[model samples]
Target: MSPVIQEPAGIFITLEGGEGSGKTTQARRLCDWLTAQGRHVLHTREPGGTLLAERLRSLLLDRSAETIAPETEAWLILAARRQHVDHVIKPALQQGMIVVCDRFSDSTMAYQGYGRGLDLRTLRTMNKWATGKLAPHLTLLFDVPVRLGLSRRRGQRSSQNRLDREATQFHEKVRAGFQTLAKQEPRRMVVLDASLPLESVQRNVTTVITRWLNARRRQPRQR
Candidate 1:
């Protein structure tokens, strides 16, 4: 696919959660629904979106790399976001396409801030610079107990991601981090019960998204 241009006017929706929260599943579902509604949709994932970002993804997710410190890992994530923002996401939105990102800046706060106990101030600063003041129009936080989520992860053999290899406590912290963020930004973030059946969760998600889109459409364009 050709690259999307910079400065899109469309809405950006991000799905955030801990492991096994169905972000990938729901993100794709949302994209398909948007397309069925005749809206231009772009589905992407964090730590990866642009070509360069994918390369960085490999380095960041290599579980065997024991020497990578937490601070370094956070920087790598931010760097990938910088590239993704400038090269892919920003452009897709400029074209007025709905962009469903599997994860975004929230993941950084959850993983690096809460999980790794990094300085939130530094993370926020880096995030602002990387995203160029671009905030998601809406963020769906798939809330689930860390134990259940991590247990589900143990059954998946294909996930060799280093971040996925962290201890259960780390994941618990990540979940707590997302919860904190949701509380702090209730207007922009909606925490959804992810333990429900996929269809049920999807229905709720569709309802919320449809209403948000409809409302946006009804609003008069600002000069």
Candidate 2:
């Protein structure tokens, strides 16, 4: 079923990237910045954010979990996303709270469709149904080389997960998928160099988001 579009006062922003692209860190930074400005913000992540979704995340990320089929993985992610949207994202936005999400439907497209060789067209349709066609107003894609991003993850003790154990070539495909997506949706997605120093990346993120917010403020409200 298609979702009825509702014009919300709050904005939805999402962060997308391949493994170890610093999405979680950058999302937190963005939330802190927005919170400092006296804005009501909800910082949450995908495959999570709701109680059931978090359990799904554990299953998806657990290295010890049974080997999951590619289609099964895709369906699990979509299920979690549906719950997240219904229980967390939709309500927050309706309440006029800016929602900064760590990952969203794009991750499914990149990871499952691209990395696992699933059909992109089918994935897109499923994602729309899962999310009720609730597209993010802005998506910040943290672009980084596969090797570099993987290396950064390896350096961290807590970063190891099921996805992190995938073949290097799989990650390359996912990275390429993100690039292809960015090219296709240049207006809604902004590519930032995640290889830069943390402070530099955050600076660019702040500047880009600031401009978007300013322009949003200038627009007349829908009656």
Candidate 3:
């Protein structure tokens, strides 16, 4: 008997936002909607989607894990990203599954590059090397005020992740970082008002994604 093999011909979508911006909520909603539409969607989150990545996520999030240098944190994230892309994302995509990731390279740029004051040039190089040639077809950025997101995150019952436990200034920097990215890449990035009602936000996001998918479907097949 021979093992089965599957090839993926699907799209990659990433959801990004600062803490309490409702990214997780929206990501789940988007996944459910896509599945209902008969798409094979693989929903995952960054820093811990795979076995190796999950272990790193634990260390990265533990508040008492000792102070992690900015450059070191950046390297750890990129390392997880490289392994995650090679093992999980690439394989799922090859299986013809739409991959909806909760967070991707943008988080590293926002959290590490801007928030932690790491060099953006280095972050870009790491991202490019980690991802190889694949890029998300669409990125939904749930934009919210820094204060509002911090308040919401603080309200969560679970102790904040190490990153989340950072001072409010850090989170504000992250919010600004994401805003900058959205402005820089308006075409591939959709900025949604996350403060809006969840239902309304979800509907707007769905409409935009559906339209993009339709447009892609209309394109002529390449030889």
Sort by TM-score, best first. 2, 1, 3
* TM-scores of all predicted structures: 0.92, 0.95, 0.92
Q: For candidate 2, report its TM-score.
A: 0.95
Evaluate all candidate structures by whole-model CA lDDT and list the values in order: 0.88, 0.94, 0.87
The segments of candidate 3 whose C-alpha lies over 4 angstroms from its true place after superposition are 1-8, 220-223
| Tens-digit lDDT string for candidate 1 (110-209) | 9999989999999899899989978898999999887777767777878846766778889989999999999999878999999888899999899989
- For model 1 the local lDDT of residue 165 reads 73
Instruction: Specify the poorest-scoring 10-residue window by lDDT in model 2.
Output: 214-223
Tens-place lDDT per residue, model 2, 58-144, is 999999999999999999999999999999999999999999999998899999999999999999999999999999999999999
Error of 2 at 209 (Å): 0.3
Return the TM-score for candidate 1, rounded to 2 decimals. 0.92
Q: Is candidate 1 or candidate 2 better by lDDT?
A: 2
> Once all C-alphas are superposed, what RMSD does model 3 give against the true structure?
4.4
